[model samples]
Target: MTEAELQQLIFDGLRKIAPESDPASLRPDQKIRETLDIDSFDFLNFLIALDERLRVEIPEADYGKLNTLDGMVRYLLAKLPK
Candidate 1:
């Protein structure tokens, strides 16, 4: 999937976890947890939702790489099947 598609998928997952969040206002370089006030549990659920939607396993070690919108898109772009 393209970066835009991945970004949308991430936003969708975030919506499910944090309904109050305004996806459009999210900064690409900002940390998602801090921006959304997402606790550990919510973040885990968001990751699970993304994994289910994208059919990709995001290992724990890579979680740091997904902390920001731009980072997540770049990480997924590299990991996603060709």
Candidate 2:
């Protein structure tokens, strides 16, 4: 998928997991969990949701790399089929 699509998917997943989160105020470089006040459980669910929608398995080991919007986008971009 394209970068724009990935970003949109991420935002949509965030909304599902954290309806109070304001995606419009999200900074790409900022830490998503801390910035959005997302707890561990919610974060995991968000990741799972992303995997379900994108059909890409993000291993637990790589969870740390997806702390920011840019990070998730970059990581997913590499894993997604061209």
Candidate 3:
């Protein structure tokens, strides 16, 4: 998928975890969990949701790389097929 599409997937995942959050308003350089006020469980669910949607398994050790929107997009793009 394209980068824009990947970003939308991230937004959807975040929305699923935190319905009150405005995923579109998230700062690309900021920490998504802290910004959304979500705890670890919710964050794991978010990542799992993204994994299911994108068919990409994100290793737990790589979780830190997904802290920001920009980072998530970059990491996912690298994992996704060309």
For each candidate, the alpha-carbon lDDT, in order, equals 0.87, 0.90, 0.89
Q: What pairs collide in candidate 1? A: none
Kindly report which residue stretches of model 1 are placed more than 4 angstroms away from their true locations once superposed.
Answer: none
lDDT of 3 at 82: 90
Residues 1-82 of candidate 1: C-alpha lDDT, one tens digit per residue: 8878888888888888889988668989999899988999999988888888878889999999988898989988888899
Give the Å error, residue 9, model 1. 0.9
In lDDT terms, how accurate is model 2?
Answer: 0.90
Model 2's TM-score against the true structure:
0.95
Residue 68's lDDT in candidate 2: 93
TM-score of 3: 0.95
Highest lDDT, which number? 2
Please, what are the lDDT tens digits per residue for candidate 3 over residues 1-82? 8888888888888888899989999889999889999999999888878888888989999999998999999999999989
TM-scores of the candidates in the order shown:
0.93, 0.95, 0.95
Residue 75 lDDT in model 2? 95
